[model samples]
Target: MKNTLIVLSLLGSALFADAAKPNIILMMADDLGYGDTGFNGNTIIQTPHLDQMAKDGIKLTHFYAGNSVCSPTRGTFLTGRHHHRYGIWTANVGHLPKQEITLASMLKEQGYTTGHFGKWHLGTLDKVISSKGAKRKPAENFAPPWQRDYDRSFVTESAVNTWNPGAGNRAKNNPFYENGKALDPDDPTLAGGAARVVVDRAVPFMEQAVKDGKPFLSVVWFHAPHEDIEAGPDYLKMYEEHGEGAHYYGCITELDEQVGRIRAKVEELGISDNTLIFFCSDNGPEGKTPAKRRQGVTSGLRGRKRDLYDGGVRVPALACWPGKLAAGTESDVPLSTLDYFPTLGNLTGYEMPDARPIDGQNIWPILAGEMDQREKAIPFIRGNEVSLVDGEFKLLLPKGELYDLSKDWSEENNVAAAHPERVERMSREIAELLESFKTSHAGADYNDPEFKPVGKWKNVGSKKK
Candidate 1:
């Protein structure tokens, strides 16, 4: 309790810090689980800085990703709208359309320098890599970050080994790109833990923006604890006792170190009070089965990634903006990465246009501790499986298994049998929402003739029969 007072007092002191247009930092983890960080009650992993970051701001108890997987969720974060509206139904399926006005583009227009660092699964960043006599077909998938209006960027199109990213087997061959050029095998950061390189590029970008006296929007998406996960000897040493799975836990700590680095830089630059830093995972843990050795934990949640269950969609979310947020406070109000666009838009005075359909609500009121309940229900869709959640009541579609999340967060109880009217209503709502996905899937959302959906793409896990 004493600690809480100290933190709160510090936050109060910064309530009037210089930030009419605050700098924003959005950080995301790949395949990180709901209960994997120190702030999220994972005692085994050491994330001291992240836990303190949460204490200095708000920890969202019921935060969710835009989607359960990578590309779709990323697309959702970039645009204020859901990914299905833009044809990226699954990872590696479709590119982020040029027509979509992304948060970076919006902030760039608002006099903010925008940069993206780390994994950019929204689209391929290159044309091709030719180790063989023939070339691969990312040439057909080229939509680099510069084209998306990111002023600067250092990113890989997809996942890479967390340790020693550049040298690897065929699957770990994703190149690290800076702007439009390759990172030039000589770059030292290319050989380290994934987060190390990510922050290496990120800090400089923020520093440049600070030097220019411009508010910046930096998206640092780390590919740690994802597939092909590995930890350097240094990070692995921190978890020497976890045996083979130590790689997962160790790399997370490494990533946390970078998080700490970012926070310290913000403070060092005297911008901590005016900069909003948000951290979250893209989804729940990877691999339901033990042998996947992903070693990811969802605390005691019911499902892993790629499901309609809460564990699949719920993620650990922390937001810290010292000037405007109370310290050590938590809000159970449902929030989504989809809300970042609208919330930041509202704070920065970029009004959402009336013509475009956006799913996110401006959650600045909730972040400021003035609101409790979310204004709109959060709809979770993967292929044809849809889950319509109106507050605690989650109505799973197709079979209508209803669960009150407030009572059974693990989702062990199906209350649909007891609440017929609720089931019928939420089912009707899910059906209506599914029709929206179908309309968007049919390319109705694309006003540009150049925008194209991958016609033959299948979700692989789509339950749509």
Candidate 2:
């Protein structure tokens, strides 16, 4: 009887351990550069909270945003698939099709409460509202309000205006309820100007999940330090001491404070050990005047926002899961925001819909130090331009510039001519991938004009040139 009782107790413990799953919180900052946070070796601005989070988590040195721009990067995060697959390659255009499955929808199936607070630039139209209103045709003027992605979402009509910095153009009637009443549009606390409103909504939602004893996934995407830079008084003071570009620096400082609050709340709720927090930016800093550039920070990488250079796509990335990920350690493996869906699904035992191809792989093994590197290369595309990477060797085409990233981090030296064999192999591989992708979006091109190349690369090394 003693032996049987001991065996039964062991079985019960194993079953309970297997049932435990971690809650997830993903925070994305708009237009935050690679060198903005102190952990990335920034000495100019104070980001004690972000710095602390980096210290407590595993800092990802080579993590990328998947795309070099906003809307598409967010799309990748939600789908774990390439944004180009859905024809979402830029910002403020259309909605992610309702047919497509999203991480939020998948998590909902696993009994997780999901919420998205802040910038939802993925799609402009709200299907719930559009279906009730007069029939509107698809055009530049008649765009949707929100993507059919999340179960509960508080998203902006467009990127929030940080210049004038007020809550303008939010959906009337609130559509979604808060405290049994529609949220007040003019309520300064819920305004979309700074990080406060998004953080405010997120904390309460998380607290409620705790009370309900349910696992939750909350995404807080902040629209700050993006454009028309503005700063609050308290944050302004930090930049004032620097005596130049105080406004831009102040905005970042304010963002840091909000990050600190979220971290504190997790600890207060005693969920720090069971909650995984992943923080990153959508893209790099937007190019501006030197004064503005002084306020904006990058990790000395070439190019700014909207470009395919390392600086544009490779922004700061950090993940903290307390007991799971070793504190104060850094992983140099290249990881993308696209991997979030698969990673989260694996952690929560949520089986992602197997109907469509998933571009992201499960990086949990890499994160847990089981694997030293990814087995396959990651591919990126924007318009006709494409880039492919195999380990440290990267071949960027349409320009056909090749660089061994292990040696050249800034991409100043091109070795495309030196290694013709590598160039041909990668180019052919990319060509085959593109051919397969074209067929996937054949019927639904939306007849939008083909993407035109925008920066210096278009003139210097493009096939058009």
Candidate 3:
């Protein structure tokens, strides 16, 4: 039988290389900063396609943004945990809790085809939009994104108008919904630069999930230089010498021309080496100072956008996958965005279930340079403010302050009195990790008692059982 046809052609070439997985997209960038792009150096923000997608791959210099704001760093970048365990403790408060477990419902249970598009501040894309007599109550955050698994959505229940985004009062009170309907408030493709109307509905949902052969995830979350930030008139005449910082550097060079139109639609669907593409910023840069349309800059990194420091939880990461990451490399470690759901559940072998408390680790061996540091230790919180960081120290908490971020990377010297036993061992490990994030914020990692614990539980550095 010719050795059983060479073991069934090596098991059909290992199931065609496990069904040729990687086609993720992830890209975020609202309230972006860490020196708003030119791939983190920002030489006057032209962002030649995010400086050639960080010179064609992997730049992630000490990334982060698992919460310095924006819906608790987008619910710890889709549930690798730590968005105050469940109650998304910030920015338009709590929501995304249909018994949490996302990254588009675990990559739509690993067959993928998820979508998402722009600015879904993690809930309330209209279940009859009426937080009547407003104070933002949209039916206690209705949780959309096509009911949180998103096999296609075009979202936006927050911040519109980075130029004509369907006209005014925050786009007639948070418009653009699609896949759960809403869009037409005169929707002529919602006109112009809101990152090219969110990559014109994310390039037709990555060309209909590569014309239905599947494998996609495309969560392109841009709202470019957030707020009512405007620019169009040729991206404000291409920043004519930055007067009023030319609409925040022309709405971040019109969101870096839709990140070069999603890297030229993954090299025109040849699927640029299986297509990975990540990017960052959901925090850091919305101003405590630099105004005139808040010219967001943090290359000096101290504090911005609701200060948890390091310019409000770092930012500006990048990735890309043309033949699996490695052009003009750079790393710095300390990644986050809560390691994008356990590094895409360890690059699609998928098994991410120990039923909760997954504060994001499997960083694909720190993005395949095969690790150097960071083996967990990146906690933080707001409204009572606590911090941690760990290797190469950080601490902070109720102002106990420490910082040796490899010899004060602008956390300006406060050795916590020359290290009182490393601040009593990271203040008893941030009080036993804020009492295991207050027992996963009292829903004990859900078997859903209808997902309880709705907001305001800031016990911060822990204790008071």
- TM-score leader: 1
User: Per-residue CA lDDT of candidate 3, range 1-465, in tens?
Assistant: 334433443443343356588888988888788888877787888889878888888898888898788988898898878888777788886688887778888879978889988888876766556322155677777788888888788877777878878887687667788888777768787887888888888898888888989988888888888878888888778787777779989988888888898889779878888888888998898868777888998989899888898898888888878666687898887888887887786667666565677887766555656556767788888878788898788888778888888778889988899889989988898788788878888888776666668676667654334
Please report, in order, the local distance difference test score of every candidate based on alpha carbons: 0.80, 0.71, 0.80
User: What tens digits encode model 1's per-residue C-alpha lDDT throughout 45-107?
Assistant: 888988999999999989989888888889888886878776777777667877777899888
Candidate 1: worst 10 consecutive residues by lDDT? 128-137
Q: What tens-digit string does per-residue lDDT give for candidate 2 at 291-383? A: 653466677777778777788888898999888889998898888898898777777666544446677766776776756676556777766
Ranking by TM-score: 1, 2, 3
* Candidate 2 Cα lDDT to native: 0.71
TM-score, one value per model? 0.91, 0.84, 0.35
Runs in model 2 deviating more than 4 A are: 1-17, 125-149, 163-185, 191-193, 443-462
lDDT of 1: 0.80
TM-score of 1: 0.91
Collision count for each candidate, in order: 0, 6, 0
